[model samples]
Target: MRPLEVWLYGAGLVLSFVAIVSLTRSIVVTIAKRKIVEERKAVQQEVQKKNEELVKQSALVESEYFVEREAREKLGLGREGESVVLLSPSATEPGIAAPVPEAVQETKSNFRLWWELFF
Candidate 1:
């Protein structure tokens, strides 16, 4: 073959190899970008689904019947025309205060009187 023809062929081969490498790199990058986009879309969908679920749960809790039931049970409240009877707990429970003896009251009064007299 002629020298110029050999050089021209070699140049064309080099150009083709460079083009293939560039195309391959571009293809890989494009595929990676597509995958990332798909993942982002999936994550967004999941978040939206969770948000919808939360909205539904909040709506259930905010319903009037749920509020009324909770109030009736927890606060001893009654709806209109509904009778509510409250029963007192037994004295043995922790919240009840024991009655003080009359003697103790008299002693305390005397002590207060003595303290005032001294001061």
Candidate 2:
């Protein structure tokens, strides 16, 4: 009878430990799944926001004003009766070569450069 009682108690203890472990794992999995759902929701919201911005940009691109502005700025097109005056580059164009002023065109030898650096 004593041996039987000890066996039953040991079985009960093992069963209780298994139950606790299973419950803890289930709770952890539930929490992880909830966190995943929340992350998915946040990503979905960000995607929706990006979609809305793209829609707005698409609308702007489709508008006549944007087309006209892009044409005027990019293609150098002018409206009817609006004469496009061509202006020469005002020292800002990269292609235009200007002579460097003599004062700024000084070339120093290596020795002179070293002397200047030290002194």
Candidate 3:
């Protein structure tokens, strides 16, 4: 073969090899990016599910708290006026004073203050 023809064929082979290498690299990068995207989607789905579960649990806790508060306020079921007789451990021991109930006037005063502030 002539020298010019040989040189042209060698140049064509080098260009083809370079193109193959570049295409292979591009394909590998695309596949890696796809995998990363899928993994991120899975993690996001799990987080969304966990958030929904936590919201449900919070709502249940709030309902229970409301029920207990309603029972306490509306039923007046707490030991309101029952008297307790204390027995002394020993006759020589000093006797403790009876417990005194605090006045409910503070709650009324606070309620009036809040109403005045808001109105």
Tell me, what's the RMSD of every candidate? Answer: 6.0, 9.8, 11.3
What TM-score does prediction 2 earn?
0.65
lDDT of 3 by residue, 1-119 (tens): 99999999999999999999999999999999999999999999999999999999888768967666665667644445754444545644668565566876455687798999999
Candidate lDDT (C-alpha), each: 0.91, 0.92, 0.81
Residue pairs in collision within model 2: none
Q: Pull out the clashing pairs in model 3.
A: none
Per lDDT, what order, best first?
Answer: 2, 1, 3
TM-score of each: 0.60, 0.65, 0.52
TM-score of 3: 0.52
> Which lDDT tens digits does candidate 2 get at residues 6-114?
9999999999999999999999999999999999999999999999999999999999999999999889999999988765575667878765567666789999999
User: What's the true lDDT of residue 4 in model 2?
Assistant: 94
* Candidate 2 ranges with C-alpha deviation above 4 Å: 88-119
TM-score, structure 1 vs. true:
0.60
C-alpha positional error of residue 54 in candidate 2 after TM-score superposition, expressed in Å:
1.3
Candidate 1 regions exceeding 4 Å error are 80-119
Using lDDT as the measure, name the better of candidate 1 and candidate 2: 2
